[model samples]
Target: MEAITPFLNANQQISVDIKTLREAPDFKAGEVDIDIRNVTPLFLNQEEINAHYLTTYKFRLYASQAYVEEKGIPQSIHDLDAHTLISFTKDGLFPHTYEPQAIKCKQHLIIDCPLAIANAVENNVGIGPLLPHIARLSQQSLVPILHNQLRQSLNIYYTYPASLTQNRMVQDFYNYLQSLPEDFLKGRTHLLAKRPQKINPLSDF
Candidate 1:
């Protein structure tokens, strides 16, 4: 919505649907014009769908200022025992390498929507994992927690029917989305391996 909202006129309308797709969609049927999803091995094994890489995201733990003030900061994964954990449903769907770790929380707030999870965390619900860009939208109310020790990754992909390749508007919109993430992709790790970093204290809330 952030990307498409700017250019809309007053009378225009737009809709977005979020789902965990079980199979490659029949885009030729015209139920929807475009699809965006996190790349998975299932997406790789299918020949019917063509997934275009958009950008990679690092999912790091965050706590709102209000949360930290009440429960104190968690500097390690072990520290999370006392805290509530906010997470998404369908946690086991992705391969470990392509997705983030699914934690076992003492107190869990499980929701399917990423935006909703961010809002819950922002409202001082619990510590949750979110991409930095999403957390930045929190206006610094969310503070990074145990960032060096625990993290997850997601690779976003854009898809459409191979049939749309030559259509001008679809092509242009896809091209625009492709270009939008150039700056966001910097320093993001799509790689499964990386050098280790030194641990630090969680001081700032």
Candidate 2:
């Protein structure tokens, strides 16, 4: 949402309501007025939307140097089974599961939040596939794994209601989101494996 904040701020012509669907008591298809739905690729039912598409999200995996050195890097599609899998099961299916028979299921663990999975992998609990954006933030502590077999991307959508007001602001916001820097969506882990300096703290007088 940060990526498109500028667009919303630029336009003052429309009133906006933000609601967390998870918190809504009567938030059913029949109750709420359907205006527009900006859906993420993570949606289990992309076919349900069948509307406008804005952009895509790429998913990647990260692992520890020890795991790679010991097991050897996975070189082909079937190699995912060789590593421990971490995932946030709130969405029901793994990101890569979108494709038919993409990876062989081996060891798997489900956490409640995105941060939880990221934190676990960062601490070298196991290798995990996550949004590149999240991976980038953790790169200083974690390493990316299985470069060849981990390639996949998902599309984000911006569905509009029949009566969506023709405001330049909404359109601009979508454009800004689409125009976000590539790095904002990707995590660079190769650099993390290199030598990193340790910081020491002492009591201040």
RMSD of each: 12.5, 13.4
Error of 1 at 134 (Å): 2.4
Clashing pairs in 1: none
Deviation in Å, model 1, residue 197 alpha carbon: 53
User: In candidate 2, which residue pairs get closer than 3 Å at backbone N, Cα or C atoms, i.e. clash?
Assistant: none
Give the lDDT of residue 18 in candidate 1. 31
* Residue range with the least summed lDDT across 10 consecutive positions in model 2: 196-205
lDDT of 1: 0.58
Q: What is the per-residue lDDT of model 2 for residues 88-203, given as tens digits with 9 covering 90 to 100?
A: 45333244243343455577777745567778777666767667678767654456666655555665444432232353333444466458775543321100001122111000
| TM-score, predicted candidate 1 vs. hidden true structure | 0.69
Judged by lDDT, which candidate is best?
A: 1
**TM values, all candidates:** 0.69, 0.58
